[model samples]
Target chain A: MKTLQNFLFELCGEQLPSGFERMSTGAKELLAPLVDECYTDRSGNIVGYRRAALANAKKVMVEAHLDEIGLMVTKIDDNGFLHFTNLAGFSPEILPATSVTVRGVRPLPGVVATLPPHLLSPEEQKKPLPMDKMVIDIGYSAARARELVRVGDPIVLRQSCADLLNHRVCGKALDNRAGVAVILNALNDLVKMPLPVNLYVVFSAGEEFNGFGARHAAWEIAPDEALVIDVTHGASAQTPKNKAFPLGGGVMIGVAPVLNGEVTACLLDLAARNQIPYGREAMSGRTGTNSDGIAVSRAGVPVGLASIPLRYMHSGCEVVDLADMQACSRLIGRYVMQGGAVHYE
Target chain B: MIDAIRELAGVSGVSGNERNISEYIKGQILPYVDKVYEDSLGNLVAVRRGEGSRVMLMAHMDQIGLVASFVDDKGFVRVAPVGHVDPKTTVGRPVVFENGETGVFICGSKEKKEPELKDCYVDIGAADRAEALRRVEIGQTASFLSNTFETGRKIVSGALDNRAGCYCLMETLRRVKNNSCELYAVFTVQEEVGLRGAKVSGFEIAPDVAIAVDVTLSGDHPDARETTAVLGGGAAVKICDRSAICSRGIIEDLENLAARRGIPVQRDVLASGGTDIGSVQLLGKGVQVGGVSIPVRYCHSAVEMADKNDIEAVIGLLTAYLEK
Candidate 1:
């Protein structure tokens, strides 16, 4: 039997942009070997099914978003610079001098431009340039740039998953791609054992812009319950204690008004029984993830959220501990395979 | 009453982590009420059976505090505010964790720019990350360490904003012997973050009349914003706040009860801020809703002050109204 960690490492794919997640195709290929059936929904979500042996078994949906924050080209300037706006939340301060991959007629490399300090006045040096003021220099003339790229083309930060100091890895778009990896790994493990519930593994799309994909997916599937996996802020020297978690602390279980109390307790109890390390996240209002949209979908499905701690979110050098991802996968796999009779209240 | 307020104020019950305070309150109110239970959202619901109307009285049991999100290698812990935690009141303050570990809160920068809550950290005196992990785990909450003290006729504590209301509710539940209505005294959860607990419990209870007992800002200080409520001005009968416009019938009924019983009352019109009354007003088939507020000074800070007489007035008015 193959270990879950090995299966997850094999499932990690290229970084995907928000609203343009081709990760579903890669996910389908990985899931093809394990599940009984697989398909894609209208919203571009990938669904894998493992039918329960019993006829009256409850349907459970486990989902993770396939989208990541990126930028979109708005205009090309006379100087061959491309003006862009963010597809999701991005700190303007981190965009300067960052490398990007612009998907146009052909993939093109570009770098965010920064004004020289010598040319700037003292007051200008004190403030970071706004997103509209910043431009991407693609080493092309205005006419050449127009031929190579068009307005509304997606541009993603260029970074590959690489090892960091403490069993951690740095890359772009780890916020949700890691979550996708967890679902794939968990599903791979579940196929090895007898399943008690009808499982639906959905790799949802367009979570960064809005939860359109998750909302539609939930409405269509109408599962008894849902578990959403995403990324939460990782602890850093500068990050606030309450808003972040340690990179390797374990998976975070969300506690919020929208999340069902009994389901959350079940997940926590499963983690404790399995000796899996986990943390608690207190979401007073909206969870700001796909879970928010999925919770109120249709007749209101009970939703639970599990998040891996990620550092420098929406930046070029986003980091997460690989061990945390594995832990999250293990917890999900155990809960789905062994979680007995979940009661929603 | 003072002892109950002090005891409730001393316990830490940050939003989403109200188990400690909820259990404490369950123990205290279980003996007085006919039935006591907790909701799935951690709301402590105690019932006193009677006749006529089913009345729901709410006071949130949770308070604002810092939740440890991350711990660095050097033992410094990063925290996020559970509610509206002002950075000014957090710096240099001693914070106590749920596990009895204490830490000193500090800001990461020494610059003149106002620091956001994210720019704060807690130093728990651990030598390294491993030591810090031994004492505190990620996602654990730590509240400001403050002791209730009396100056003149006022009492000051860390969580007086809502715990004082909790004390008022418990005291009313104990004192009201001839209640004409079926009373559901609910100590709600997660009110510091939003009116979350009240939202769920209100939908379940669906009472005939609802009243939120909470602390409202008192504009008696020299620097306070313009408002009609003042310190030691008796119970502030809410006409309206940001949360809800108190039902006219409920407001008049409370005022008439106070007038007949000779209990001191003050009319309040808060410009901003909210209570659970907003959620209770919108629950189920709708219900008559109002608020009885204890005017508090320096709310959402380490030192929140409430007058003893104002607290007494709230308890007396609520008890008299229930009896009627």
Candidate 2:
């Protein structure tokens, strides 16, 4: 668990395009010696691979989107309230009164602010907050605002991660950045296991915004099967038991119309064979990851979903356990090491 | 010959939106021109009743697409590209709206470098999506402001290549003046997409002597194709290429006319892409056809610099060679 936490921390600290240049340079260096070849796509999806010794061995793809929920600078109003558009689906209520750093040539610190309750009518105050009225106030004059920050600036949470109760680590972008770390760790393990299948560790972009990057990556890199590794909400005493999977219990492996049934069965069987703990996560349809694109691809690529359990999904502070993270990597690594053909539906 | 070329280049029109150009040809020879009308595809057709000459002079009215697609609720609109829009030129361009609402192409994310056409959209200072949809629809199109200015001697800049051909047919009608042979000059729509408009027009006209007038690449630009026929080389005679293969007999006729009348002409073969001649060649029982091309630089872009002298010579050659 200590080794797992340190590995995830190093991956999280890597200057990923989570609004940073030199993206994947550090992450690529960390995953370098393990994977035989690696490259980043135009859409910023990182691709690392492990080759099979045999010529006709099965090819497998395990994907994790590199993009996370963030803010795009839409406008800077004259009153100095910075207007923002959500890069992905985000609650305006969670945004206001939250700290965020505007990433630019020079990072600018600011706070998302909302219209004063005093200014709103009692009728308006009762209503759900509108994104339009919400703005980020960096406490600068209009001229200075124009001089300092331009539109289209990437905004990230200023909140640093913390170690929560129940052996879970909390962070600003654990929604799927934690999933990115799991793939890196899985690739790290494949270095020793020498999987019989050709394994591709993919990092998708724009999954937080639009699936444009994922759709393109699926088209360009068409693998036989795609396993999207993302973070699903974990259940707690406060969370409805049925609504979310449990935190630190085990990895949540998904089964659905989106994921191939045979492929997912192999996941469950792999977990059992390796004696790795995992929970069944029933996804109704279109698992909302790069899996969505790969499922309905040209001829449809068989897919599987392996999720890292996290609490407070889509918010600033999210939690993930290091034990589940390590178990998730091992389960996927073992599956690709011996997984076979999926029966066509 | 050049007047025909200039008429096509100088006319201002956008994709799915060519009125002035279509109307200009309508008055020139609407009487002798058979079945003159606009198609659902936005192509203008002028037919000279000829059983012998199944021909289509294909040219596009659309130069490039405008930034029309918008994102409403967030104040930006997804830009729908009307034609082959270069994303590099779009970053800070001032786009003109159909209702004259002006706005700049917003690069909403600095992390994104040189947005692809689909990645970029226009943000007209609309408060929201309802206001944006009120101004622009999902399928509206516009031009990047028609600009024709003097760059140097005989060298001119504007959207011409095919429009120049559109005008050539217009003037060619007057030049062919009283020819009894059949001719069809199709000022086509969406040629930028595929040689689509001409495909339909050629299927309709099916003349015997099918000939098209379009612009071709010139070797005049610095470090250009080594085998490029130079700028102002004369009316480009198309031998063969991807889009169309000119019949040897028709090719002989045009070259004989040029040689006999002392009209300077350059022989050309495009390495890639087929033209309307590809369509005209397969019309009906197969019309024997060729093409007269004007040498131009920077095709399919704004500032499609062309040689004015070469253009005029094409008009002269088209007018003189079209005798019945």
Candidate 3:
């Protein structure tokens, strides 16, 4: 029996950098068996459907972006050093002296160049080096570098998903992959019991670059109600109290104008009744997630955001707690079992 | 030599991040030399044993560029200039990170004063701090986004300043068949950052005579007339720069060797700027030093142009002197 940790790690390993989501064969394989019918949409979003027990059932969509933040090659220097740009934003600080894999004709190993502290001046040592000074050194000369990599080739931080102490998992691409795992876990349980509504599980693409994938998935499914599962900043000493949630604090239920009031109420009620730990995140305007895109799809959607607390988000070592993920899975499962029939007074 | 310079210009080794350039140089010089290895500061040192005085040939591998110093809330990356990057040249240019993440180097339009490093930022199309932090980090270095192209008699590209010097030494090492003097062809690191790499490698291999194969400022351009060196005039034999004065004996030897070999050459006397010769000259109890400078137009900027004939002269003169 494969655990949720195994599933999440496997999903995280899929190097599905934004705009390159079509290369997600392994992630699709892991998801195909858990649903009644699985297919990929035009935007490269992987959509799965599970039919309800009765006829004329309400459609409920659960979405998690499959795309991860990465880099793209912009130029190959004469000595075969690679110059690149960000696919999505990340801190410029963590990039220096880091190892990465250039997804070229074949995956090639490279390192981000950094000045050794000894080489830096006293004033320079206090300052951060600029991104333009950084170049990916693949140890190839110009002729050979051009043979292997072309401009626009995707590059990802070379990191492997690993289980840490206290059921915490760490690696690259865990931001929304962890969300995808929660949906998969819920599907595993809901498959055993008959669902009241037709469940639509969408592993979306292009959420990091833009919310186009989620918007496309929501438009196609046209779900009456939607639940978006993505990662939120996990509490760390570096983060402020309101800025981040605890890693083991279960799911973060987003409360914002973008989210449906009734749906948010029902999700909070379900977690309490099911004894699942959850925290509340209040967004004044846009949730800065697929929830914002999904909520405004077509006419409109009564959408809710359920986010797992993830630490060190968008870096090579994003951390998430398995217990929190399991709790999120159960809450979503219970929501489906109740059919998300939240009626407004 | 032109091909070598073009290839060397393609690798990014901004001061400290010199591994790629170092490794590329090692591969090229390895098969020809008796022994080749990298020193602690990432300098590629290749040697051919001989019975005469140890002649250390130095050329730095690093170039000038920018480093990510800070990231603002809106995903705009602030940069600190690495080496001697002119703020004027950096604006509106594209820069690429070591991880292959490229960004447009820009500055605040509202500032009326001349653009400074603090006012500039790299926009990688990141929406916010969190988004930018996902792909890049502070302290990661970036080099200018440019290509190596030849226009008629001149080859133009970024990093050509020292890469031209590197090519000359590489060609010299390749052509020199006999081991007369013990040769130390040291491709150094961090020359742009106060010649730090040369300082280390120079101390390690204290030679009887040292020669820095590097680029000198050319005065052929319309805006510049104060410089003594000119493009197409042949290799510039260094007399004096702000950093180090050439040894009288080495300068005479270089001039005599160039004249004997029928190689065209010019005298280089720069009012400012320095190269590996500056640091390597100070090594040991005391060492005699000079330089063979490839006269380059627009020394520090992208699109720095070097004459093919001058590059050939540098390679020829170095080969002739080494074979003697």
Candidate 4:
């Protein structure tokens, strides 16, 4: 017996600057064969739904954002240089000399320009150049560059996912794309089995900016419960151990006042009963993910968060453990299949 | 008021781990209110039934502290701040976990120019990771050692930034009798991290008029940031802070009430910092929000200082307003 498989999984176009529609379309094409129903909403959220076999059953949604931190061209200089501002929070120290793709009239490759040490004053050399002072050089004359690129163009870091030591990988926009991968992997497992509840999968958009996508989707779906999957800081030598989780430490479950206590407890119990490795994140307030917006949606939804540990977030070379991704997917899949319950007062 | 402040200050209630303080506040205000209950977010909401306007008075019960994130093989416990923690105040200070396990904060090394949170660790006196694990598990929160003492007329203690606020609210609950309005005295959680508990409680209660009782920065200190509020200057009627603005109507109403009652009051326009007023203001359909701030010095540190006279002024004004 095939269980209800009503899920919406939206893949945001690449980086919100270039290849956004194209990448979203690619994700749809890849996921089209897996779901019973697939569609995109006005907010550009990809939705897939698998109906439960039981006539009356609870609805559960799992969401991950698709947008990545990027830059927007603010001005074009006469010397064929482009000045841009960050679309999201970015460390200035990591911007210099990084490769970027400008989604101008056509995709153009550019490099974040840096002043040579010989030209910099001692004081200027001591600090990283501020975003306003940094420029992108695409090797074009003023007239030629103006013809191809204009102000307000979106720029994305030019990097692709690459394998690392063990079952790890690093790439650009892994802060949330890795979350999308987790949903995709979980869907694969759920599609083959009968699910206990109706599932809605959302690949939300604009989480890095305003969380508009998740907010709209949550209002429309009005699910009984939701699980927001995103990235948390991974443990690193430079980061405090308490502020970050281990790379291969499975999934990080959030404990916050904003989240539903029952849902959080259920997720933890499922992890232990299933023998899936998991860690706890003590968030005093606001999970700072799509869960925040989703929790406060129409009449308020009981929301839970399962985060994948990521290192170097918002940077081009973000790293994540594939094992953790798998574990997150398994935990979500198990929670949904076991008929997750949340009391709505 | 001083006794309540000392009592609440001596309890450990860090953000996301506020059950102990929630229970304490519930027991303290139960007899005065008609009904007392806890919301899903652990907000202790005590309601005194009345037929007049629904009014909510919020005071956050949570304080800033550290959460155990990682433990090393050598028994060093790595921690992350649950709220805005100054690393300078954390160094060489004592902390107590929820289970009463104690530890001393230490910096990683002296090599770094400016020590960041990453360069800090807590020595729990465990010989190794196994022993440390037995004492404190990951995800548990620990607050600065709770201590309250008086020097002359000034009271200094940890968690006073909010416990003082709690004390003021409790004193109001006791003295305020036969009010016309439906009074909701909410002891909220997680204000140090963000105004989270009030956000949910505000949404649920939907109070017509909401006021937060919290500590405001006192510029009376020699090295303090410039602020209009000062110690022993009486209760500060907040004009505005970073998180919220006191509605003009509420300000006028409070001023007129204070003047009529002959209770001295100070106007507070804090340069920075936030309280639960912002959350209550934005709750469903909006609420006319204001704050009664107790002037506090060295906020978020172990030894937060407040004047006894200022505490009494707050208790007097709130009791008058509620009983009016």
Candidate 5:
């Protein structure tokens, strides 16, 4: 495995939409040396350990899911347009007018095929395009496309991840890639910074779909405390003040759920101690992260969730601030090194 | 527009207690209005001179509420609802008495499954009816009780149905410019019941145009339609409703005005319900009428929501419309 020196753009996998298989490969490569050892389970989650990295240390699991949400090639019509069944939750309204690529025998670029305005009935234009009525045009004939495309082949959208008006970068596959980046950076920093606890950096997988990877990782490496880092909504003028996090603001520490109180407190304390400008990740219920699986793992593990605010989350071309990533990396690594002991009531 | 919503939501004007809300509007709008007076019914009226075309813009000050009708020997007072209320929301809700005594709302028939008005009662910290009378009168109308708190941004989750409209007008007064015709911004009372405040205020202002500012439902939540305007989509301009069809020219003018200027606007033909414009139209000579609506989610609940951006958008459009 190539040790990626620059954390910038190492290919998690050479191909696209192969979700967990690709993402877990990226995570274990980062974890290979930092832990006692690392391995991928059947579900494709890469779990690594530095068992008892410290004396009588609290066993803590830090997870950032490694899967990216995408579509699956269900059918390819002769005109080369591909019909897809969503591998994850996605609204069809936003699906139209977006570019996508199919990963098969060969990678092919395509546009989602939408009905021509002139051909549509008067009623259709006035309403949103419903799901199942949409298609992707790969611009190929049915026979040639079918030979190249399989039933379960993954498809990825081509959303450019670049800086926007501010320091905001727009890109596709950010949901867990941002989380993957956080885990990689933290693992590298672990060697430089000794810790008071056993830190098992888990790059969980399949969270975008059924959370299969997270569940498998939870059972395989059950830790006392789990800290799952994922992306939440970032600020836009359209975003409500209460429900948004600004891009430049540091990582958002989840506090509202109360399941991860100790971990959240530790993250907050570390951020404050380290002079990190952090924000609150307030949600009323489950964080909808791998933390959800890790929270109820075994006899119900207590969990904390830290979120990197990304604009247009789950949607392609999600935007995140690099400052948030750096801050999250610093906060998690330092907190783990300081105290691994957790006493939850 | 912000002022109307803030003032309306912040005040405790549930019903008969609208006196304080009425007093606030009277004070703020008295000087700017052409002729200002309070009706025998306590509805406040402010008339800016109307010349070629008259206009009456209304916001109801009162909300669905309970009136303390009887006090039990244990100081538990039986109350009556003054307007349309979901018996469901009132159960377990906190309410304040006329004398500032706070109590939890409970139903006498918890086992019955469905509670009628007689089954619900308000318990104050008192020993008897004689003592309860000192704090609450029989005619004491208590409006929907909701405290304003900020969870994020500013979330004031109670009783904003018409108060938001009232705030819209108050902001209009603070920002509207240019006066070709008379503009009547009336803070009417009892609109939740039968648009009573507008009935009298309209007769008094009797301008050619009538517009009501109030809350409209925003169905843009998860699983909501894209056509459903969101809290942040912008101000809703009423083109027609069950009560009345908005004048075509007025609708076109506002639409053109919004397009000419960069204001976010959504067109609405309310599937049901009526605004104070209905009462305003019926008051004397019918008035050319329209409305500016705030798209809010959960209109009657503690978490009623409107987008700050949409509120600001309405403010921009109103300023432009009033300026000339």
Candidate 6:
């Protein structure tokens, strides 16, 4: 039996940038044994299905994006350095002096150059560096660079998962990988027992860029209900109490206008009944997740969101607690066993 | 000594990344010294033990360079200084990474009244971000590239600032066989980054006296800032610099030894800049410290030039001082 930390390490290590989700074979292989039927969809989402005990039963869709924010090659300079643009929104501040791997003709190690503090002017020190001014050094000449790399090739930030003292780990791509891990763990139990509803699990693509994967998955599956699992911002010293959830605070139950009120109440009630620790997040508008797209897909499918508490959402060192992930997995597992109670035509 | 200086100056040992240079120096001095070993902070300490006064000869082996930080869209790599690099001096020079990959240092901005480091980038001929990333990585360091060559009596090279000092100490270690004092020839690390290595080694091997071998600026060029030293003005005995005031006893001893040995020596009173001696002076209840510096032109630039004869004089003076 593989440890949860090792499972997360292997899952998060896969380099699945937005448009490059077809390369999610590693994740698919991991998901293969968990579901009765697992395959990659046309829209680059890994979909797994487990039939309910009764035929033609109602379906419950569970999803987490497989893609993480990364960089893409824009232009190669005459000197053989690489210029890049972000695939999704990420803070430019975390990039300097960070290490990345350019997924080109061959995987090559690269570094983001940082101007030494000794050279900084008083005024230049005050502002963050603009992305356009940054480039990656790959130690190749222009001709050799052209031979080895091409424009639009994805660049993945490389950082090994560091195990913390508590049941916590930190590394790149934990945003939805933690959610994926929760689903994988839940599927281990869901597949063995008789599920009350047809289970449709989607490891989505482009959730960091767009909601195309979830939107398409929801339309195709057209389930009676949907559950979107992802990572929510964990509160830190810098983050406000209302803006983020705390790590080790168990699962975060999403409550918003678009999310199904009955489904939200069901999840909250189940958490209390099962004694699964959970926190409530009140969003004024869209949840800024795949839930938004899935809710309105195919003349409105009701959605419920359960997120793992994660710190440093979009950097190379996003942190997540195993306890929270297990809690999220258990909550969803119980909800699936209960047959996803509230359903509409 | 000039040949050794040329050889040593060709290698890169940028501040934190001093392993290669340390290994090179360790191999070179091992045969001549009694015992040689590297310390925790990468200082190469070659000692010839004796029952006499504990004397230390410290020289920094690290050089100033740029660390790759951000690569721009056009595959141009922006860098931060690893030490003190004047953006003006670095423009249009070639830089070599530890892997021997070369890049052309160029400034991209036109809005500069005086361009700072942010305006500069290293062009490795990468066509785009992907192409550039296939070769270079972030946090990688690069040293100024210059082949060591001699014109007339002057030798020009990059990293000559402290390599010349290292060569001077290595020669003295080789020559002073019948030494009356305990000699600790330490090729220190990170002197360009505030004399870090010397501080650790100085406290650990708290000697009776410490002498830093390094390069000092010469005022022989046009619009020179320094007035007291010149390119061929022999080994400059430090009276005072920004870092430390030379011990009076050690200064007198070095000067008298130079007179007896017929070695050319001059008094150095640099208004700015410090070396390993500064940190050594403050170590272990305060050790008596002095410096023996080779006068070099264009001190921290790529084309740093030093007089061959002055390098020899420094070697002779240190050899005589240690042998006595």
Q: After superposing candidate 4 on the true structure, give the runs of residues whose Cα lies further than 4 Å from its correct spot.
A: A1-345
Judging by TM-score against the true structure, name the best candidate.
3
Residues B1-324, candidate 2: write the lDDT tens digits: 344445555554665666765677577657656667776666787767755444555655555557464456766777767666777755566566655666666566666655666667776788888877777776566555445665554545456756777666666776676655665667776666666676677666655566777778775677764223457778888765455435556667888888888888877656555566665554333455678887877665556767666766777777666663
lDDT for each candidate structure: 0.83, 0.68, 0.83, 0.82, 0.70, 0.84
Write model 1 residue lDDT over B1-324, tens digit each, in one string. Answer: 667778988888989989999989988888799999988998999999999999999999999888899899898999988888898876888999989899998998877588667779999999999999999999999888888888999999889979999999999988999899999999999998989999899878878889999999986789665355788889989866656645657888998999988898887766568899777664433466789999998888878999999999999999999998
lDDT of 5 by residue, B255-311 (tens): 789999989887664544678876664333235667888887766666677677777
Q: Give a tens-digit lDDT track for model 4, residues A1-345.
A: 211112211232355531132335655664566678889764567888888878778899989886677776756788999987665546678899999988888889999998889999999889887777788999999899989986545688888667789977777878787887778778877777877788898887667655657876887788999999999999988998777999999999999999999899999999989999999998998988989989998788999999999998888888888788878989988888888758445
Q: DockQ, in order, for the candidates?
A: 0.01, 0.02, 0.01, 0.02, 0.01, 0.01
lDDT of 5 by residue, A145-229 (tens): 8888755466777765555775556677777677777777777777665666777776765566546566656665677777888
TM-score of chain B of 4: 0.97
What is each candidate's fraction of native interface contacts (fnat)?
0.00, 0.00, 0.00, 0.00, 0.00, 0.00
Candidate 6 lDDT tens digits, A1-345: 555566688898888877568776778987889888999875678999988999878999989889888776656789998877665656689999899989888788999877997999988889888775788989999999989876656788888898887988999999888888888888876667988899999998778765567876887788899899998999999998898998999999999999999899999999999999999999999999999988887678888999988999889989999999999999989999998957657
Report the candidate with higher lDDT, 1 versus 5.
Answer: 1
Sort by TM-score, top down from the best:
3, 2, 6, 4, 1, 5
Docking class of 1: incorrect
Measured with C-alpha atoms, the lDDT of residue A92 in candidate 5 is 76
lDDT of 6 at A146: 83
CA RMSD, predictions in order:
18.1, 18.9, 23.3, 15.0, 25.1, 24.7
Off by over 4 Å in 1: A1-15, A22-24, A339-345, B1-324
TM-score of chain A of each: 0.93, 0.89, 0.97, 0.92, 0.89, 0.97
Candidates by lDDT, descending order: 6, 3, 1, 4, 5, 2
Over 4 Å off, model 6:
B1-324
lDDT of 4 by residue, B64-173 (tens): 89999999999999999999989876688899999999999888879887778888989999998999999999999998885788988999988887899999898899
